[model samples]
Target: MTAGEPDLVGPEILDGHLYDYPAYYDLVFGSDCAAETAFFEDCFRQLARRPVERIFEPACGTGRLLYRLSRRGYSVSGNDLNPHAVAYCNARFERAGWDPPAVLGDMADFRLRRKVDAAFNTINSFRHLDNENAARSHLGCVAAALARGGLYLLGLHLTPTRGPRDMGESWTARRGHLGIVSNLQSISIDRRRRVEKFAMSFDVYTPTRHRRIEGILEYRTYTLEQIRRSVESVPSLEWIETFDFAYDISRPVVVGNLTEDVVLVLRKR
Candidate 1:
């Protein structure tokens, strides 16, 4: 770990499960690994004008996509603000006998010496930017780092029109002998300011013992229109199209009462 980067990966119950441990985080979401990677590959094939020999993943938590990209023979590089995530990714690559290019860096100011053919931020990770300016800066930096006419795939939920609503969901996954339950809830949403507050509770179960760790998170919400406007504000990026989580590019984006999330295909101008 670097000087200021955190070395802890969990067991600090109050700090939250995800912030503390990479293994629990992976177990909770790794079930969808195949689907997520397939979506990324599909987008690259459908949109990129040039072959995607290299990819850059910003806010790449746990290197899920990065690992998959490498497995498919694409050169992969990524960065995460969380030092734990960066360290975990590096270790993961090492275990697989592959060199890892993940590092600790802020998305707003991250830069690489070599430009990549494409970049992506998956699973609502981009919403971590709390405001429009921050979001724009992140996009601008990504655009500046990508090759000319290269593609950028961004995925996140679109704010609903029915005003702020509370929602909750839960799912279970296993890691070896341990079983984990991930419970997520939306505590509040500020429609006017486009911010949503949420919480996560992780329950870990062993045969004889059980533990719970919880944490809160906040995200800046974006509607479809706001997303288009934000991209417009980033001079080097052009909005190409939007697809829902299904990753079906043939169908046009339906931004309506029920639309909640989308993956936007953007090009570096």
Candidate 2:
């Protein structure tokens, strides 16, 4: 069976934790791995002051990007708060006959034995640090883990100043005999508290088995000004440029009140 393909068994419904199933998570999110990896390399080439030979990823679920980067000849390491993700990543590395560096660690406060050339945490994972203190600490930690002049690519969606506050999206992906249909919707949006509660559900189908998984998650919402202030709190890192989800290094954008998706390029001072 391929990765993420469930065994040929009976039908079942599970109220499962989303992050606990790394393979299925990869199936949903890993399709753009090559594009994202290329984007990272381009960012390093265009924006980084130092050669990005060794890179790190925080909140690297399943090491999907890490594995791809390693294959591309860059030294890669990452950490995740989920033990299952850590184990899954390490297992993949071991299968490839490479040393595994994914470890169970918190993104807000974790240390690396050696500094890296560049690091990244994308796709709004940084918003998981639900408080100002934790967000500041995560920035400080990433700054400390980089050499001088190193770059950190942080990507997230900013809270919109206008329009509908509630939002959602759905995705469908298939690998081999496994098919997954996933939906993510905001159940609650509290502007005053800077929080958004999300309801996520996945319907999986195999040849002989069908499973439905559900999970709820929360992310801290940040306006453009709020994120700017948070970045300013860490003096060692300077925000250099802002890009949108397109991941195009050639086009840097000015984040205005209307902008939502943003990728901030920070350089260690």
TM-score winner? 2
lDDT values, one for every candidate: 0.81, 0.88
Backbone clashes in each candidate structure, one number apiece? Answer: 3, 0
Query: lDDT of candidate 2?
Result: 0.88
Query: In candidate 2, residue 74 scores what lDDT?
Result: 93
Candidate 2, residues 1-269, lDDT tens digits: the string is 32255556634678558688888888988877877888899989988889889999999999999999999899999989898889999999999999997988899999889999999988889999989999999999999999998999999989878775448888888998998888999899898999999998887877666787887889999998899999999999999998887877778899888888888999999
Question: For all the candidates, what are their Cα RMSDs to the real structure?
Answer: 6.4, 3.3
For residue 198, give model 1's deviation from the true position in Å.
1.0
Clashing pairs in 1: 9-20, 9-21, 10-20
- Find the 10 residues in a row with the least total lDDT in model 1: 1-10
Worst 10 residues of 2 by lDDT: 1-10
lDDT of 1 by residue, 1-269 (tens): 11122334533254544855787777887887887788777777877877789999998878877898898999999988888888898999999999977998888888789999999886888898998889999999999999987899998888866665338678889866777778889988897988888898887766555666887889898876787799899888888877887766666595665578788888987
